[model samples]
Target: MTMTVVPAPAETGHSVAPPGRNRRVRQHWGATPYLFLLPALTLLGVFFVWPAVTAVQLAFYDYRVVSPAEFVGLGNFSHMLGDDRFYTALTNSGLFLIGMLPILVVIPLLLAVLVNLPLRGIKVFRLVYYLPVVTSMVAVAIAWNYVYHQRGILNWLLNTLGLLDQPVQYLLDPGWALPALVLVESWKSLGYYMMIYLAGLQSVPRELYEAAAVDGAGPWRRLSSITVPMLRPYIAVVMVLAALDSMQVFTSVFVMTQGGPQDGTLTLGYYIYDAAFRHFNMGYASAMGLVLWAILVVFSLVSYRLTRGKAAAR
Candidate 1:
């Protein structure tokens, strides 16, 4: 007897595709990795993207804590222009960048190069150099505070070295305060940047240096041609990081001087804190915070773009 093949009847509600036709469905189901990424995408949208959009919205309005946001339409931007405090913070921040950038960049690069040499106990030196990077910023700030105080270690050393007529109150003097803070920041930041440069330096091939030496290239020539060019990406990273950190400097200034000595050390970061907590001008403080963020964004973008151009050129 011969058996006949039978086809199943259609579903009551939904229509089922033929077996070969369901390949597209199976292909879609195979896209599980992207589905897994949906959670992270949602998180980024909620945290970073949402907050950024909100910040931009907040920038436009003169918002009050109790009252609804009053749409001021560039009023905050105009107000910031006439704000002497804003100008002061801008100036101080600029000065800080000027003072700290060179030291932070050059010293770290130099240190990295030196430590990367085939010398004895270089690992120990690397560890010693990196200690400050891991050390607590608060503890470092407090330690420096005492050291910078009148009759403290710094003053005592100055006096011992016969460099000062008296124990100068480093934080109290308007002229000295900002520089002092910059020095402290530089000291705290150097180790981290140095480590970064060290990592970058390690990737540089040894053959290049040997070839440079073979060609009668001196130390300066080798550094200028080989070391400097090779480290451009790292330099870019260091500069952008340093710029962002220096631009928003607050904690040390807040704890040490509280933007003291005639507001000499009054930075945008400090001003934002003051307007919010001290003066309770949430709208103005938010405006300033947004402005600070704008500055950071602009600087970072510019630096990144330029770095990309240089990298492309190479």
Candidate 2:
């Protein structure tokens, strides 16, 4: 052996397989993705899944924070249906959603299109439009609170313009409270939705627009024939987002009106907060939250189905 000593394979740059053999390696690499996903999956299970399950379970029981949780079995649902306040909140939520949907959806699309136009300083315009989106909701609510005040800048501006005979109680009057809140919510959300639409618009092929132009189609016609059809997914996304945001509207009502003036601005979201924190009915509040979640799920499913059906029809 000493007379015929040979170098070990480690010292030489030789391997068992041929060069570039890495390309022949199995690309699937099964189980690696799942292994990497384990931490996130465990966190989701512990944080979201378990809590949601417990909330649903507690919903069937009549358990206040201070009282024993007694199994009620749909009693909360029955009570909800029978309660006038619940009905009022539901109605207000419906009205708010209806009033805000068009503004939330249409305004953003228009803004996105406008900013996407081949014009100078469009980036500046985009920044201006997106400013509201990044602003804090609490700050937005507070600013709007002052604006809607009877003796605030809004009234002053109206007075300056001679638009009204006197100051209006925007948040105090039942007739105006919901609508006022809706407007503020739409304004705050418009920038975010507009950004989403902008991204979608950017993804749309410019060749289609050029082709439409070659075919002697005008801007509106091109939009109808090409832009709208291609943007169905984004539209669906906006609708669902607007609906969810509208359903979960709370901060504006809390800060601006506190769901006051005969509970005119009381939404389901506000009701949950009121029940849970204000009244200290934690168990009942959890039940209400579960019910709210069910309602939201139904609304979401219906909206999704309707939007998808329309898209499919085309």
Candidate 3:
């Protein structure tokens, strides 16, 4: 006997995941980012946000270690208005802003351009440049003491080059101390800024530089046109960071100068530390901190304005 034949049902092009699995996947996508961000958010709140709030509260109160906190009602700020040391610290911070701006922003970009060249041993040059970035500031400061000594390498070099009539006590001279600190700060951080600019440089298309060269454009022209325009975002970022760090300079000052040599290198940051810990003036220190925060905001705004341009961004 002949058996009846039947055709199987046609298969659909797509497989339908189970409803439970689909729901689970959607839930995972929604929750995963928040889960990843939870730790960082917690840390930020604990460290930065909480401290900021506490500082604001302390700014309005006279909180000393010896007694209970008393409400001051801006007395600390009014006192800050008359503090001579405060003005001196402000002036020193401004000088740092000026001295480090070019050294940190412009010079690093130029150096990055040089090191970005396709040449032998370029990686070695990058490493050498970046070594100082990883070096501890305390160690660097200690080493620089010898460098600034009367019979030190720096003095010898200056004398040999006829730049100095004699070995001037760099960190000891009131007129020279601030500038010397500026130099040290710049040298310590130059490598880090260079790496930033170098990263930006490498991200730029090789074809642009080659095309510019083919059209008889010089290195300077190509850099001014292609490199600058493309690296606008990086420039803005670097400028803000440089301004913030320069204004908040403390470690080098604390380690090397202790804001001494007639308080020539007394930056606002060091002064804040001094007021808070050394003199037990928490309210005053908090007030000064708020002022410094305002200054940082202003500086960041100015830096962004200076570097404002349409960037061929990453």
Candidate 4:
């Protein structure tokens, strides 16, 4: 007997999805993240983007808060070339960068290595080191003011050690003002850089140290060969950060010296503030700000290239 054969349903060129599948996919994959990000994006635009654009526009226009903005094109920037104080501020900023680099970049690594040792109550030491980083800068500056005072503990210790003939006014002396501020800034931020190095150290393999030790490598040799090379990226990051901090040093200068003692501590940041607020030369200040920003950008680019090239060579 011949069985009656039924043809199965033919497949279509386009397949139909389930009724709610597309809706579910769309709901799960889209819009939610953007919706959650809306607040942050709005805040950033309002606070950062808007202010940056205003600053750039104001760089070309003379605005003294009381007077109408007068467009002068590159006049503000041109004026900077003839301004002696601008050059002085630039020079001081460079000094800060030079002084802070070793303090933040090199010394912090050693500090991190010291704190990273598996010793009892080491966390307490780490916490103490990081305390200044978390403390308010204003408070730190006030505390440092006492430390730098003519009759303060620092001077007393120096006198006791016969390092000085008499107490010196650190903040009031032109020769010492910038260096004093640099030390304060460096000390306050040392903990931060230390934490960064500590984090980098955590990822390094203990086996490398073991192997190096097995090969008769001493601590300094291992540090120079393994730790330094491994921490290159961290060093690059710290360098860029420290450079930026040094270049834009304002609060310490303002609080401690007020750019006094013959303007020895007049950093670019403080100069911008002085021009804008004290002298009411907002346009010139904005121009200087732009120049400072350009300098920082250049420094970052150079640092990145050097670090990346070294990394690639290795």
Candidate 5:
């Protein structure tokens, strides 16, 4: 017996939909993921967006905790122009950025190179270098306080080496206070930047170094030509991060000098804190905060552009 196969009836110029089409459509445009994201979005708006709006609004008003807010409309910003302390803070913050750049950007690269060596137990060295990053800033300040003491080991060594006529109080000296805090901040953060560079270093091709070596390139030559070029992106990241950290140096200053020794260690971050909490000038503090934010944003953009332009040129 022969069986004949027949085709099913077809619609006129229209295809029939599969039973699973609606299910697939629902899955493609599902609202479940968005529903899950709503909580985090709500929290972000409450914590970050709300506070940012409040700060901008408060910058236009004079609000001491004891008095009702009076709309001053750029008065706080205008006051910043004539404020000597504001200028001092800005100058000190700039010095910090300068002092920290080498420590964070250059030294860390060397450190990453050292730790990237294939020696036995090299991981131990990396961990040792990174320990300070996880340490509490307050604790580091306290320990550094001992080190900066007149009779401390550092002073003793300095005296032994004839670097100073007598023991000097580092934190209490106007000339040394900012530099001392800079050292503390750099020491604390060096490990973080080193780790960043280490990651970049690891990603670099070993074959490049081998090729350079075959061409009779020395260690320094290979580093300058290969490692540095390859690490440019990481260096850019480090520069921006270091600039931000240096500008906002507050904890060490607060714990060690309290922006004192004749305000030598005064920084934008410290000044903002003092204006907000100590002096209760909330509007002025907010204005200064905005200024600091603007400076950081501009600096970051410029640095990023320069780095990217250099990379592209190469």
Candidate 6:
């Protein structure tokens, strides 16, 4: 005699997922992040992308806010060749680019090195240095206005130190106005770039410096051989940022100088603002904006290449 077995029946209320159900669930989860990003993308398109497109279109028109836009093709761009103020603005921007490089790049590196040392109260010093970076540019400009005054703290210190025999007005004088703005801009930006360099410094291996010291390397020698080489990538970043910031110098010129004293401090950014708002030359201003944008693109590309080449060489 033989015994036979029987199969068990399916569960009463349990449902089985259909084929590809797990894949469908995974696809739904993959789309979840894009749903979260939708709000930010919408705002960016509405605010930035739309305005940029409008500006580019306006660059080809002759629109004065009160008048209807007339298609002018490249007329607005051509007009820039005959505009003295345009050239002046370009010159001022060039000066800012030159003036900010050393101050923003070298000084910030030095400050980062100093702050990175294992000294007591170093964190306090770092906080003090970085305070200006978080402060509003408007407030910084207002505060510096006093420092740049004819009889202000800067003049008094210079006088006491015998550096100046008489108080000279900085923002009032056409010759000194642009330079004064450069100083203020550089000062405000230094702390920001310093923190960047500080981050890079902290990432560097401490063993290299220790080994160099064991071999009797001095501070300057160690910095030149080890620290500088290590911080090169950071320097490239700072250089790009500084170049972009310098070319777009505006707030200080607006608040402190108003691009005044015979347009001495008239940077491309300030001029663009003036043409659009003050003079109501929206089309011309938009054209200038496009030109400035092109310049920035080219400048950034060149700078990045140079820095990358140097880093590779080293």
How accurate locally, in lDDT, is each candidate? 0.88, 0.85, 0.91, 0.92, 0.92, 0.93
Candidate 3 TM-score versus the reference: 0.85
| Root-mean-square deviation per candidate | 5.4, 5.4, 4.3, 3.9, 3.8, 2.8
CA lDDT of 255 in candidate 2?
Answer: 86
Can you rank all candidates by lDDT, best first? 6, 4, 5, 3, 1, 2
Worst 10 residues of 2 by lDDT: 19-28
lDDT of 4 at 231: 90
User: Lowest lDDT 10-mer window, candidate 4?
Assistant: 6-15
Q: 295 in model 6: Cα distance from truth in Å?
A: 1.7
Model 6 stretches astray by more than 4 angstroms: 1-9, 12-14, 20-27, 303-314
Q: Quote each prediction's TM-score.
A: 0.85, 0.84, 0.85, 0.90, 0.89, 0.92
User: Native-vs-model 3 lDDT?
Assistant: 0.91
Which stretches in model 3 have alpha-carbon errors above 4 Å? 1-39, 302-314
lDDT of 4 at 35: 88
Top candidate by TM-score = 6
Tens-digit lDDT string for candidate 5 (1-314): 99977655463455678879988989877978988899999999999999999998999999988999999998999999999999999999999999998899999999999999899999999999899999999999999999999899899999899997989998888988888888999999989999999999988989999999999999999899999989888888888889988888999988999999888888999999999999999999999999998998998897889778867876
lDDT of 2 by residue, 57-122 (tens): 877887777878889888877777787877788888888889888999898998888998989999
**Cα lDDT for residue 118, candidate 4:** 95
lDDT for each residue of candidate 6 in 6-34, tens digit (9 for 90 to 100)? 54445445566776998899999999999
Worst 10 residues of 1 by lDDT: 5-14
Cα lDDT for residue 39, model 3? 100
Better of 3 and 4 by TM-score: 4
Model 1 shows how many backbone clashes? 0
